[model samples]
Target: MPYRILKRKDLIPGQTILMVVDAPMIASKSRPGNFVILRVSDKGERIPLTIADADAAAGTITIVFLVVGKTTAHLATLREGEDILDVCGPLGRPTHIEKSGPVICVGGGTGIAAMHHIAKGHHQAGNRVVAVIGARNKDLLLFCDELGSFCPEVLIATDDGSRGHKGFVTELLKSRLEEDKEIAEVVAVGPVPMMEAVAKVTLPFGVKTTVSLNSIMVDGIGMCGACRCTVGGKVRFACVDGPEFDGHAVDFQELKMRLGQFRTEEKISLEKFRGQS
Candidate 1:
């Protein structure tokens, strides 16, 4: 049976959308930090997207994605009741969720879209979830209402000061760290630089930190090695091993550089696709 788009919510007009697909097995098995690789058509390139939410009872899972390239732009064109060719996953090791007290989860930009599920997982585990989320501006921010429902406290920041604190999310995180909240652990997921900055800010406090890496992937499995990165001096695959890792031990600088390697090619591919259209 084809995986049908059960529901769709256009979040940022041309930028991002939330899709609920009919994938029961994947939904039942997926956990926070797990991702899926999807192909919109026979020739479509497989794209990895983190699971934003899942409802096993409904046999559907939610995925939020930005329309940055050919594949995503194509995916966005798909409307409700349309079918996606393949939706393969629940891949990547699940986040090591635990009862770590008073945890801080920081999500910058599109990362905030996926943060709610991860934060919900922690909240259900008895951890007080304090969320700090930001985007370049208020128009780009997401998940504040839903995340705020489960989390007793939610903090927001915007680069343009259209809504919350007028600065980077990292600046807000730094302020919270200084407040003596005894934050037991931190989870930062966003742009590579944002995650790196969060790790650096929490380093001096010696707070345990984990970052959900968004390294590019091909197969969304170990076979391709496209998502390989140096973590704790060992080669780790973001697909099979982890989408989340020890922030202090991860080599963010290396990951950052590696993420840049395909940008030019990606841009070219995007341009070519646009020209053809």
Candidate 2:
């Protein structure tokens, strides 16, 4: 069955889009950190997106994506009533949520949407959730209201000094870690560089840090060696083993290289797609 888009919202108007899709099976099984691989058309390339939110009762799953390449640009053109050709998921391991002490969740750019669900999970588990999110400016920030609805403390940062802290999210994170000695863990979801910075900030404190990696994925299964990354000394597949891993152990440098491998070709493809449109 085709996955139908039930609702659509332009979170950033042409830059970021959010879709609530009707996919009962995937919604029912989806958890924080789980992602779905979808194809916009029969001939389109498969792309994996994190389940921003899932409502089993409503039989819908929310997906938020940034329009960065050809497939995403094509997907953004779809309307609320359109049908997605195929959606295969609730793939990858779920985030490990426990009733620990305080937990800090840091998100940057579009990654705030993905971090929202994980923070909700921690809140539901009776753990104190502190959300720290950042963007280039107030206009670029996302999911602030959603996170503030549940999280006890929602901290924000913007590079242009248009919002809360006039610096990076890591600065707020470091301050929080220093003040709250009871912080249990730190979870970060965003660009590789942001995640790397989070890991670095948390390292001195020795706080357990988890990061969600956005690797180049083909088949959303372990069979394809495309999503492999080095965590510590071992190679792990982001699709099957985890999209989440110990941030301190991950090799962000290697992940950055792999992610940029297709930039040249992707830019050409997106240009051609736009020309056709």
Q: For this target, which candidate reaches the highest TM-score against the unseen true structure?
A: 2
Best by lDDT: 2
Quote the positional error of residue 20 for candidate 1 in Å. Answer: 1.1
Error of 1 at 183 (Å): 1.0
Model 2, span 1-277: residue lDDT tens: 7999999999999999999999999999999989999999898899999999999999999999999999999999999999999999999999999899899999999999999999999999999999999999999999999999999899999999999999999999999999999999999999899999999999999999999999999998899899999999899999988999999999999999999998989989999999999
Model 1 stretches with alpha carbons more than 4 Å out: none
The CA lDDT at 205 in model 2 is 100
Superposed Cα deviation of residue 258, candidate 1 (Å): 1.8
TM-score of each: 0.97, 0.99
Worst lDDT window (10 residues) for model 2? Answer: 219-228
lDDT of each: 0.90, 0.96
What lDDT tens digits, residue by residue, belong to model 1 across residues 177-226? 99956899999888888999999999998999999988889998799899
